[model samples]
Target: MNAFEINGGKPLRGEIIPQGAKNEALQVISAVLLTEEQVIISNVPDIKDVNKLIELLGDLGVRVEHLKKDTYSFQAKDIDLDFFMSEQFKAKGGSLRGSIMIVGPLLARFGKASIPKPGGDKIGRRRLDTHFLGFEKLGAKFNYNSKTNFFNVDASHLKGAYILLDEASVTGTANVIMAAVLAKGITTIYNAACEPYIQQLCKMLNRMGAKISGIGSNLLNIEGVEKLGGTEHRLLPDMIEIGSFIGLAAMTGSEITIKDVHYNELGIIPDIFKRMGIRLKLRGDDIYIPSQPHYEIDTFIDGSILTVADAPWPGFTPDLLSIVLVVATQAKGNVMIHQKMFESRLFFVDKLIDMGAQIILCDPHRATVMGLDKQVQLRGIEMTSPDIRAGVSLLIAALSASGRSIIHNIEQIERGYQDIDIRLRALGADIKRINTMPKQH
Candidate 1:
């Protein structure tokens, strides 16, 4: 296992570039299975989950070439259908949550797809009902093996239909969209997840000769195409990482500039941080956060306590609520963090409270943080990272604390962020990766 040894109280400076979007990479990479032609994708983040998915693709007979740093070309000309039923597939496919996405494209291209139960963060109940239900609506037969914990979908001919999704799930929407692209006739999807990642996938599909309308809206119309060709696509900078940087800057009182962040796509992120009293400026494509000794939380217009909550696209992303909650610990006022998406994400507050931050765990979905206002410096301690976002939040908290902190299970962090220690080190952060042996039972 790996851990992070961070000496807190060092204010990071210098400009840093955010990596390509992990979420976007997962969707687009899976879409490569939709077409057999060579598809080149640039700006892919070099992270654990993304790399794992790429490795899985290669094992499944996709010709994956590493063209350059953060660039890859995939040609799925000869997919081994037998591999899907092999034990190797179960072990590899079950490890990543994103692996479930391959079912859509495979079912569309090969008429059958099977996958073991997927894994990622242990946040909460992340149901796959939306995904299988969407596929069922598109004329695919779905089956589940409870004993093996596997899912299978088969379609002799996928015909389009009006699919009113039960929820606006981003992955579900992407999966259904991929399945519908090569389907027969037009497919109408209402209440679709229109995140920037989904929009990028739709655009990339269109570039590859897939007919998809409603680029930025909840209602998407996809006219089934006979086949799709290859196309080059570039991923946007990771919005979650950018938001984490902003929160890191404010919490550590650092003057930092984040480069090449697509500002237009980061809906409600900048505004939400701005409401927390962090002073930042937009310099062309970069975001500049100045050093601040004190930042106060804002209240509602009616003078009620400010609440930061997560919703679907066009609303605040649920991914950044953990970062926002961590950043609020040092602000001048209080704020309630409502994590509407996951039930267990707020449980990390106990670690923050142990470090002397004033936080009340209202429930599984909410936490009220009373800002310390620089009057008290958080004392560092040992902690374990539960998930990706919480791990990064604890890293930010460690960066702002006094003395030193050791964060175990840093693989969770590396699963999402690429070379985080290296990037933070460039910005003068006293953080390093340390190899640790597992404790004997």
Candidate 2:
């Protein structure tokens, strides 16, 4: 296994660019399957998950070409539908959660789609109910094979209809929107996810001749067309990464500038950090974080303690809560970190507690963190990363702690962040990547 050996207590400095949005890349890449013409995408993050998806696409006969770094052209004129039923797909398709999204475009264009049980971070139960139900709403037949652990959706003629999602699930909305764009009628989606990723997807589809309205709201109207054409799209900078860097700068007392953040699309992220007393300066399209020796958490106007929590779009993203919680460990005052969306995400706080931070794990969803207030420095310790976000959060913690720290299972971090060690090294972080085998006793 590979691990990161980090020498902590050194502040990172210099400018780092946030990678293209991983989540958006997944959604947009799947959208390429909707058109037989060439769909060119730029700003694609070269990460493990995305590369895996691209391999899957190539396996299905999509003409994939690397035009340049961070840019690619995909044409699915000769798809191999038989590949979906092959044993190879059974192994590969089940390895990534993004593989499930291919069902939408395939069902839209080819009238049928199938995928093995999708796998992702074990943060919590990520159900595919929304995607399947939305497909059924648009005149598709859904079935699950218990014997093979696969999902199948078929629709010979899709006629769009109204869909009100249980939750504004981002991938679900994207799947249904992709399907609806080529359906027979109008599809109205209420309670839809309006995150920047979804907005970009809508805009890209519109450019490809799909009629979609209500770009940045909870309700979206899509008019089905006969076919979609090729279009070019560029992904937004990853907001989660930007948020992580902000927390990293504060925790390690580093002066850092995150370049090309696409600031207007950051929603409530910057304001949320401001609530934790971290100062941020917006310069054109970048975010500059000055070195902070100490930052005090804010209290509510009613004299109540501050609570940082995750919500749907336009609210704090659940993906960044781990970074926020870790940063809170060194801030002044106490705050409650509530991870309502995922039950198991807050369990990582136990690792922070082991490093001499004061944290009370109230339950699976809530934790009360009493900040160290820069009065004490955390001592580095060995730990294993449980998920992508948690891995980066631990890396940030290690960078701000004293002594040496080793992080195992760094592959989880690489699944999302592209060239993380190289990027962090550019910012003067004392981190080294190493491979090791377990010692036999």
Clashes of each: 0, 0
Q: Model 1 lDDT vs. the true structure?
A: 0.95
Report clash pairs, candidate 2.
none
Alpha-carbon runs more than 4 Å astray in model 2: 438-441
CA lDDT of each prediction against the hidden true structure: 0.95, 0.93
For candidate 1, the TM-score is 0.99
Q: Which ten residues in a row have the lowest lDDT in candidate 2?
A: 432-441
Identify the candidate with maximal lDDT.
1
Q: Which ten residues in a row have the lowest lDDT in candidate 1?
A: 432-441
Candidate 1 local lDDT, 1-441, one digit each (tens): 789999999888999999999999999999999998999999999999999999999999999999999999999999999998999999999999999989889988888899999999999999999999999998999889999988988888999999999999999999999999999999999999999999999999999999999999999999999999999999999999999999999999999999999999999999999999999999999999999899999999999999999999999999999999999999999999999999999998999999999999988999999999989999898889999999999999999999999899999999999999999999999998888764332
Clashes of 2: 0
Candidate 2: Cα lDDT at 351: 76
Q: Mind giving the per-residue lDDT tens digits that candidate 2 earns over 1-441?
A: 999999999988999999999999999999999999999999999999999999999999999999999999999999999898999999999999899889899999999999999998989999899999999999999899999998987899999899999889999999999999999989999999999999999999999999999999999999999999999999999999999999999999999999999999999999999999999999989899999899999999998999989999998899999998999999999999999999889777777888889999999999998999989999898888889999999999999999998888899999999999998999999999999753332
Residue clash pairs of candidate 1: none
